[model samples]
Target chain A: MSINRNENSKLDFLLEIGNIGSGNALTSLAEFIDRRVDMKAPRLEFVDFNELFGSVGGVENVVSGFLINVHGDVNGIMLFLLQNELASEVCDILLGSKLIDLNALDELHVSLFKEIANIMAGSYISALAEMTGLKITTSVPDLAIDMAGAILSVPLIHFENVFGQILLIQNSFSVDLKEYNSSIFFFLEDESIAKLMKQFGIE
Target chain B: MGKKILIVDDAAFMRMMIKNGLTQNGFTDIFEAGDGQQALDMYQAERPDLVFMDITMPNVDGIQALKNIKAFDPAAKVVMCSAMGQEAMVVEAIESGALDFIVKPFKIDRVLQTVSKVLG
Candidate 1:
């Protein structure tokens, strides 16, 4: 589906906002983990279910997931992904345990990821709120452990190809003296992007 | 101003890490609890001057635990130990009567600063 000129502009605006939000999250991760996190802000896009599911290697091994559902004048979903290994590292860092078993993926691990997702998503949402002058309230992030494909199979009722790109954030963080890599996918709707641009006073 | 502080978290390593940081900064009377219920029990017996509570746990999560503790002592000085992405819960905890919060993967300086700031 092709988005109109106004929608296209909005997409760009939202993508930029996502980048700033993700950047702030990365900085906090770096401070907590004491490691540098590398991120790439690709153009946002709208993908068919098949293509979207295929992009993240089928999401079959996804150990833990966090979702920040956005509701407002505009809407979309912000997803944080951590393969089992990375998820464990995050747990270890927050809990200060080098002996934590990555394979366990226990309750503490899930809870820790939920908190991390909250921070990352909250930072992003706060930035959006400041720029748009709108109060964005995010639901308690829903936590899931499923195959990547299964998770992707869940439909996004409000999907839009705002920027014609996907903001893929790659993070390398360490905890318990171990290092791991993870990524976050942010899908922005075209209308949301437009609202963001107007809020930022971007031409 | 010397005050007793309680540290509640399931992870022994984390409790030790925070204990080490706090004690080094002259917080001599420190107590440890593995979960929220344990924290409440300790709070009743110890009447600690402050608390460092973790948000997630098996028996009772941090936020609920915070509320329970606050119900007993509205003047409870609890500092939440949060991980990333827990901003909403942190806000809730603060509203629920926590004095402040500290993010996990505890930074030595930040922990000390927060502890001193809150305790003072």
Candidate 2:
């Protein structure tokens, strides 16, 4: 749980990268939703999969969800959560109509979240790629309705430290009218971690 | 001549955001729509030279609206607006005949640049 001096530096690098990525994501969200979003970069932590799951009190229901699976020399995931009202507001903004119904889960809602996630994650990964000189490609974002638990329950087994455990990076953000929370949970294989450390000039 | 632009998105805040970007860049006579259905109706009525459209909504989506507009105006100049992680849909929009795409949390510079390019 406690990172050493060298590891601390590496974490700092990741945090800085995450900060830029989050900033890019926030800017995109603001434009798309037409609302100002307050974004915060939380203190970075390294936790085993079990500890991560236990710390967050598990995933909860959300109005809209955007998730991107990041793959490359450095591996992890980026997730964006939006409250239903906010999601409807975003849908309204995007479609150019006030007719968006915020109360229901429908195909339109799912597609909107997928689009938001795509833009946010794409902007984040592009920023990261620029910083690290790495090529990153994300999977086609999957849409879900009231499926946070289903998505979180499925374990990510990429990291060797906790095979089948989910290592989570929890972060928070808020839009003008509503508050939102999101996380990036991934298991990095030892090789990936080693490469990440070396890239950060920690090795 | 300055291009006539359509702003479609349900949120007033968002409509204002795109309107600000366009007006600041000297794009006047901008029109607005709240949903995909309205967007289609507006396309038929006003037939603006350009559109900055959001991808998600209640009655219809940006993609569907984009397709509908394109179906009506094969020469329609439509730009898809999306938040993060909607790359695939963006691609679909482009293939469906959108002139280009813009990602949101709108950057003044990015929006201006995309508009200038499309107009040019």
Candidate 3:
């Protein structure tokens, strides 16, 4: 049973998984920060690299990004992006003081953000792994505080040989009362997509 | 409440949080390591009563450190700590001689409870 990637059913299935993963990640983040982390429905987009960067307020948008290379049954790159101000706000909550600037985040601040990304992405990846009965793990994660375009190019370039269009799951979340937008891009190899679809009996 | 404990994590913030919790609960003989290599070295050097080690880290990870510590002393009481989605690694840790597992974003009470049970 070969699954058609463009089929509406396939899109719906991936979106559902995205929703579940984001929900679990949000719950974990809320607990970690002790704040009300609310989320909007997850959106799944299969778009060109240029359009992908545009989705996150264009590639020039200055943001904090965390990149993790996912391994095991699911082979892909997982990226978490956060607005600079929102990154600082979360750091403030974690550090119990004001984070002067995201651009000037010191070693401690970098470690804190990396840990937060670990909790969030780990929870989300765990949900997917549990649901599919696949063994999944992530690298230690690399952080980039730069323009969205510059940060996103890392994953896009890494998966360039495997994918023409990337699967992006956009999540909108708010911490405390400040609205923040974040995105998670899952660059699954073709075989990985097939494996996931087969797990759900879609193929 | 004099049980010596070691906290291993790459994040200074995480180590500080766990240390603060353990200290507030009266567990004073505590040590910290930034990565698994440090964890293994510190475990042999400090001989802490119990260790709370995060699973993912640079250079060496928690599971490897657990294996190293156990090989040195099978009677070592070690607990693996990780984020929500690391069940596979958690199982591996337990199989490798870890006494328990703790998830991140953990409450202070949970950390204390695990310490009490493991040290007891």
Top candidate (TM-score): 3
lDDT of 2 at A86: 60
DockQ value for model 3: 0.72
Residues A1-203, model 3: lDDT tens digits: 22365677666777777789888988898999888988888776776666776778778888888998888888888888877787778777878777776667777888888998999888988899888888888888799999988998887766677765466778777787678788888777778877988999987
Error of 2 at A157 (Å): 6.8
Which regions in candidate 1 have their CA more than 4 angstroms from the true location? A40-43, A48-50, A61-63, A68-77, A88-103, A133-145, A154-182, A186-203, B7-20, B23-46, B53-74, B80-106
Q: What is the C-alpha lDDT profile of model 1 across B74-93, one tens digit per residue?
A: 88888887553344555677
**Comparison by TM-score, 1 against 3, better one:** 3
Q: Write the per-residue lDDT of candidate 1 for residues A1-203, one digit (tens) a residue.
A: 35578666555665566567767776666665566565544334444443566566655675567777766654667777777776555555566674255446566555556656666675666666655776564545677777766665543433432434445555555444556655567665666665666667765
Q: TM-score of model 1 relative to the true fold?
A: 0.65
- Candidate number with greatest lDDT: 3
Q: Can you write out model 2's per-residue Cα lDDT over B29-62, one digit (the tens) per residue?
A: 8899988999999989998988888765557878
Residue pairs that clash (backbone atoms under 3 angstroms), model 3? A59-A149
Query: Model 1: how far is A110 from its true place, Å?
Result: 4.0
Predicted model with the maximum DockQ: 3
Give the range where candidate 2 chain A is weakest over 10 consecutive residues by summed lDDT: A158-167
Candidates 1 and 2, the one with greater TM-score? 1
Relative to the true interface, what fraction of contacts does candidate 1 keep? 0.11
How many clashes (backbone atoms < 3 Å, residues ≥3 apart in a chain or on different chains) does model 2 have?
37
For model 1 chain B, give the 10-residue run with minimal summed lDDT.
Answer: B82-91
The CAPRI quality class of candidate 2 comes to incorrect
